[model samples]
Target: MLEIRQIPVLEDNYVYLVHEPVEKLTAVVDPAVTDEVMSAAASAGWTITHILNTHHHFDHVGGNEEIRDKTGCTIVGPRADRDRIPGIEIELGDGDLFQFGAATARVFDVPGHTKGHIAYWFEADKALFCGDTLFALGCGRMFEGTPGQFWPSLKKLRDLPDETRVFCAHEYTQANARFALSIDPDNVELTMRSKEIDALRAHGIPTVPSVLAAEKATNPFLRADQPEIAAQLGMEGRDPIDIFAEIRHRKDNF
Candidate 1:
């Protein structure tokens, strides 16, 4: 079985540890801070064996080199972005399968936030480690790719099973929820979730690993194809990509 845990780090960033009990192997995903990841591993009683980076953003891979030096973990990431990732030994692209002990992760090229960004999907475990590409109730900003390119990238993720657990890189859900409500006011799921988020935050609980089904229901970015959202944005009958672009544009200002 696979075990996952969240490690809170710098500001609102989140790092995750994926563990395989059979082989006692542990992989750190997007370590924004080295100390936080090391402490998390120490607390979990698991020795780090791998560093899986989803993108080259500094906040995501800032601890790559230090973590590799401290634990000698094998670093893995997008083969196309070898130049950007630090200490990357296993450069992989979309469709490439990787193993950490008995667990396997399938890579998907999900560019938009960054041109070479990728996500790791552990199909059997129904978990997705999508760094900055997909968030709890929002998507990443288009830094290197166009909205057209981003829409297709999000489609690849939306096609995954709704039950898949989404592990994002940040605690942007509350803010994203507020922004989503502006355009998706009629969405009951979003409304209820916003309240839940408020409760979770008030109690200092982490809301990083949200279920994909919930995101599908509440995330405005994913609901671009919905006519209700289109009509709300004055985009009725427009192409889904155009609607999605407008949503993203609004988010940029939100």
Candidate 2:
């Protein structure tokens, strides 16, 4: 079994420690800083052996060199952005399987927020480490990818099993929930979820590690193809991608 720990750092960013016990192998996913990641690993009695980065964003790969130098961990990242990834030793692309001990992650080149962004899906563990691609109730703003490239990227993730646990790298759920409720105000599920999220945040609890099933039902970005969502935006009968773009534009300004 892979033991996962969530380490909150740098404003709203989340750094994850994924440990495979039998081999005593642990991988840090998207470490924005080194101290928090190292501290978390020490607390769990695990040594960091690998650093898995999803993109070249400074916040995502800022600690790559520090962590690698400190632990001598191999750094793995998107093959498409090799030039940008610091200390990248293993370049992974779509359909590649990255093995960490007995746990293997199937890589998906899920770009849109960035041209070379990727997500890691560990099928056996039912866990997805998607950095800035998909979020609890929103998605990362399209900076380096076109709508054409972004929507399909989202679809790939939306098609995952409903039970998959989504470990996106931020704590933007509450704010994203507000935006979701604005356009999807009539959605009962979203309304209920917003309230639940409000309660969770009220107590200083993290709302991440959201289930794919819950996200599919409530995340407006994932439901951009649904007829009701299109209708709500007054773009009835438009192409799903067009509707998706409009929704994304609205959220960008929201």
Candidate 3:
């Protein structure tokens, strides 16, 4: 079985640890800070063997070299982005399959959050390391890719099983849902979920690792075609892509 836990660091970043109990091996996704990651891994009694990166953002790969130096783990990421990242031992691309004991993760190139951002899908575990591609109630800011490129990138993730547990790189749900309600005011699902998230944040709980199906229902960015959303944003009858762009634009200021 794959045991997953979130290592919170640097304000809102999340570094996830994926472990295989039988082999006592562990892999981390997006180690934003080195000491926090090392401390958590030590506490868990697992040896870090792989460092998986979704993108080259400083906050995501900042710990790459230090962690690799300490653990001698393979640094895995996009083949095209080797220069941008440090200590890359396994450069991968779309459709690459990686194995860690009984667990396997399939790579999907999900650019737009960054041109080379990728998601790791472990089919058996129904888990996805989505980086900043898909969030609990929103998507990532487009840094290196256009809205056109970003749309298709998100569509790839939308095709995954609804039950898949989405592990995003940040804790942005509370704010994302607040913006979501500005567009989807009457979405009872969003209202209820936002309340739950508000409570979670109040208690210092992380509102992440949300189910894909729940996001599909409550996330405004994912509901680009909702009549209410379009109408509220004055995008009625406009191209769906335009509506998507407008929603992102509004959220940028929100």
Reference-based lDDT, residue 206, model 1: 84
Please give the distance, in angstroms, between residue 26's alpha carbon in candidate 3 and its true position after superposition.
0.6
Model 3 ranges with Cα > 4 A deviation: none
Each model's lDDT comes to 0.92, 0.95, 0.89
Candidate with top lDDT is 2
lDDT, residue 176, candidate 2: 97
- For candidate 3, lDDT tens digit of each residue in 1-254? 79998999998999999998877789989998899999999999878999999989999999999999999998998876778877888988889998878888899998887888889999999999999999999999988887787877777888889999999999999999899888888889889999999999999999989999998888877777677778988878887677888888888888
Worst ten-residue run, lDDT, model 1? 97-106
Give the TM-scores of the predictions, in the order they appear: 0.98, 0.99, 0.96
lDDT (Cα, tens digit) per residue for candidate 1, span 1-254: 89998988888998999999999999999988899899889999989999999999999899999999999899999987889998899998989998877888899998899999999999999999999999999999999988888888888999999999999999998999999999899889899999999999999998879999998888989888988999999988999999999999999998
Residue-wise C-alpha lDDT for candidate 2, range 1-254, written one tens digit per residue = 89999999999999999999989999999989999899999999999999999999999999999999999999999999999999999999999999888889999999899999999999999999999999999999999998889999999999999999999999999999999999899999999999999999999999999999999999988987899998899988898889889989999998
Q: Largest TM-score belongs to which candidate?
A: 2
- TM match of model 2 to true structure: 0.99
Superior candidate under TM-score, 1 versus 3: 1
Better of 1 and 3 by lDDT: 1
Which residue pairs collide in model 1, if any? none
